[model samples]
Target chain A: MIARLRQTVWSGITARVRGTWDSVADAIRPAVPGFGTVRRGHVALVGVGPGAIDLLTLRALRCIEAADVILYDRLVEPEVVALAPRKARRIYVGKEVGAHAWPQPRIDAKIVEEAQKGLRVVRLKSGDPSIFGRVTEELTAVRAAGLAVEVVPGVTAACAAAAHMQLSLTERGVSDTLILTTGTCREGDPLPESALHARPGTNTVFYMSVRQAARIRDGLIARGVPDGARLRIAADVAKPGEQLLHCALRDLPDTLASSSISGCAILMLTWPKEVEALSDPTVATETVAPVSAANAPS
Target chain B: MIARLRQTVWSGITARVRGTWDSVADAIRPAVPGFGTVRRGHVALVGVGPGAIDLLTLRALRCIEAADVILYDRLVEPEVVALAPRKARRIYVGKEVGAHAWPQPRIDAKIVEEAQKGLRVVRLKSGDPSIFGRVTEELTAVRAAGLAVEVVPGVTAACAAAAHMQLSLTERGVSDTLILTTGTCREGDPLPESALHARPGTNTVFYMSVRQAARIRDGLIARGVPDGARLRIAADVAKPGEQLLHCALRDLPDTLASSSISGCAILMLTWPKEVEALSDPTVATETVAPVSAANAPS
Candidate 1:
């Protein structure tokens, strides 16, 4: 009984100590200063969204404005980059097919190098940094150097494309699972066979798949995906020259051939009949005018 | 030759007129007004991000502040809802297990009703609205009523949990595919058998899966997923009292038992040896303090 009483007393003391410690820590914690004046030796991985200035999160904007040096990529819009303070250094380390101005390892090293120089660094990517953004390498490098790191999520291309199209990736009783994948696999590293197949009640979005349209079509067809399945290809999404094409799965290659889609594109596969029927005709007419005109053969 | 020349001249005139019309349209397009002054009868479907107020996008925050009537869900943070203008009407339509404060159809009707009344309606949801936000129903309803609608994407729980963990959903040479799915399948809705299996070089994240831990474990094990696979559970992510637990796949049930996990949680399955090796020990130690303390039995 005495032992149990002693244990209770010790537990009470421990709880009170922890409570006091938490209060002290909360009181002493530093407040986040205004943008353009972040503490040195810290790094913020900010997502700039899908090339639209307004799509940028307030937190991402604050990070960009506060950074002493910002490293950006090709897909990020110039207008979005302009949001950085005039005093901030802007370095374009864009990577295009067959040409990488700055390779991944080099980019990771540079972020760490800048942070170690007592400068606030922002490694900005176009979409949500955690998705296809190669953030783990940079995050690992930064933390290894004992620098503070934070990731700010942004609108990925899939979400932006859906918003621009006024479509939902998942609908109750239609699609419950939304899978976001890329078509551009590394050399000798092919995606799983299951990844190519379109499952029922699930929406599949293929990023960087414009160039591989034929391969995707053949694979899906081999997997028994109906030729009549609907596909939506959005190019330069959310931009002024944005083009959206809705066609059958079998027409994906033909549709690509008809349009000059030589940039980042999102290929969405959804339930054809249900989705098409649900789309508002007025919205479709308004958004599809440019694309329809562009697709007209002279 | 005379006929061809006349045709060319007429086409040139048409092109010039169209160009002039385009320029005028661009000049007269309405600029997005400041928050709290959105045009009436318009509805903005805004994603409020996963619980953190700062994680909200600039567009989302603008929509919330500008809204005349803000309809929010249970998962959205109170601070985020508080961002709405003082005069704005706030209604809670949160969905809890066995208790939906407002049915979906009713919610849709209310949003349409408010919008038709010439009030700026903001339907705020937790995470990117297009993903599992039931946006299609609302979008269809608003468009059917001939009301203006716009969608603003925010950081989903998957992205926020990834950011909090300092892990990337996709990593080159390690994980090329990142699949986001849910564990709470509706009645008569069973997930595909293949989804239970962990693919090589892929990361699978299950949102709202804490209650389904045993089912997930059994399914994955049945699918030949190594019992030693790594599992990370993040509860109340990005909010105060957030808990993160990292354990082997087999230990999922036991680890969950030690924590007070009730609200929204993210279950992340990553490759075991490689991911654990890649995570920085210092960062892990710093972030795991609370979970480690919570897990210690008295």
Candidate 2:
């Protein structure tokens, strides 16, 4: 049966080739309207998961190795950058705090120039390239250049931190709605109302907004969310400095300030599984004994 | 500077060791807590990414290798399953339509039994093990069995499918919300109203939902989502047999039915990027098309 299927497919392909050549002679084909279009260099936007060598996708690794030049950032871990061939030209396009090192236009220009040189160029970012990674601007730039572009996804840090902490972002009847946003807003931009008005069974994850932890906590209080809602502050996820703090949002500001943890941080809030123990009559009292707060049920 | 910091940390650690355990008698006392005081055979719930070897994280790999027995399912690709050590006993807990799959309670019992035997066991699932993969139920069961539990996350398919298609779920001002939901509804449960009521700037992703494509499309249209909203569908992502179909939601049902796309599928909806062509004003009429329901935009 398999042999018959293969033979049938081969016959179909041969018939098409023969028919095309017969219909358009070589002389006439030379004058065809859409001939001799050259293929352009392709751009692959790849993600390096949360500063860890082992966390990178195999497909992402292959893309980086095949690239002629790699545009990387400080957010990408050193080990991940090492995956690229030694001969591949590397460029730093990272934007640090108070510094827009490479402006938008210039970065777009660099990508187009490399592609025009017929070189496969890769734009590498930390975590999943799509989430809060300014990928849309890069995509628009590449498309405008008429170059083919693809994106390789990576492991985002929220999942990494939550997994390591043995917590489910969407536990049944706990957190069904999961929201991903940044805690820091533009100078004139208002804070996210979703974080402020957190529903009982929803999980909110904040990326790249550690400095605004206090403001986030205050907003939740103002919106009537329980002050004792669980908050997980994870820093340097999947890296050596990896730290996971389990606390309530109300006290997160003080707790984080007391600790010297800085650098890229992810903040997560959800109705925690620990709270479910409050329903077990025998264990409810003991579970809430540790630190009862304003929202604790009587 | 790094070396100096390391030395300072070491000195502080040494000072604590000397100050806390000053006498031979103190050293002779139990150096650690009793073994039985803490339960053993804990379950480590893990996610292996969509059928690609590179998609699995180093942490997940380590956890899988450490397990004495592995309980895995069909969502886990064959290539990934091969990563488990040869000596480890692997058990099939796959759930397929009308298949003799192990019930949730049975799987939970198996984990506990193996863990009680002092064997490291991994409960592995495809995509992020925690996301709609029943990790929470397993966690609760394991904890109730008095076993320690840990979670190691992998890349979720929703993000991966989007990346593979070179599409961004959120594009700043273009889209503010990205919602991911499983396609299945419980017996007697009604469809989600929020999911049906599509917001223009919000992107929605559905998993395990290819069979419901027709119903999903109808639900969206009935809920007042613009009929011109674009839909991108991909099946068997990151694997050989992968197929992609791009079209508008209004036409998605017909497209899927005619295309005969089944098996693992990812569905994406996005508000088109509205851009004015730079080179020619005429291009505005050609490419800068209005997002009217009259045209299929995907």
Number of the top-ranking candidate, with lDDT as the measure: 1
Best by TM-score: 1
For model 1, give the TM-score of chain B. 0.76
Write one digit per residue (lDDT tens) for candidate 2, span A120-227: 899997888777677878888999988999888888887778777777766544444456766543345454433532433456777766777778777655434456
Residue A264 in model 1: shift from native, Å? 0.7
Which candidate wins on DockQ? 1
Residue-wise lDDT of candidate 1 within A187-279, one digit each (tens)?
666553324424445677888777788888776654445566678898988765688888877888999998988758888876321232212
Q: lDDT tens digits, residues B160-210, model 2?
A: 787876777666655445666555644455443224423334566776667
TM-score of each: 0.77, 0.71
Which tens-of-lDDT digit does each residue in B89-120 have in candidate 1?
99888666577678788989999999999999
Q: Is the docking of candidate 1 incorrect, acceptable, medium or high quality?
A: incorrect
Residue B10 Cα positional deviation in candidate 2, in Å, after optimal superposition: 42
Model 1 ranges with Cα > 4 A deviation? A1-38, A98-100, A187-197, A271-298, B1-38, B98-100, B187-194, B271-298
Steric clashes per prediction: 2, 2
* Model 2 interface CAPRI class: incorrect
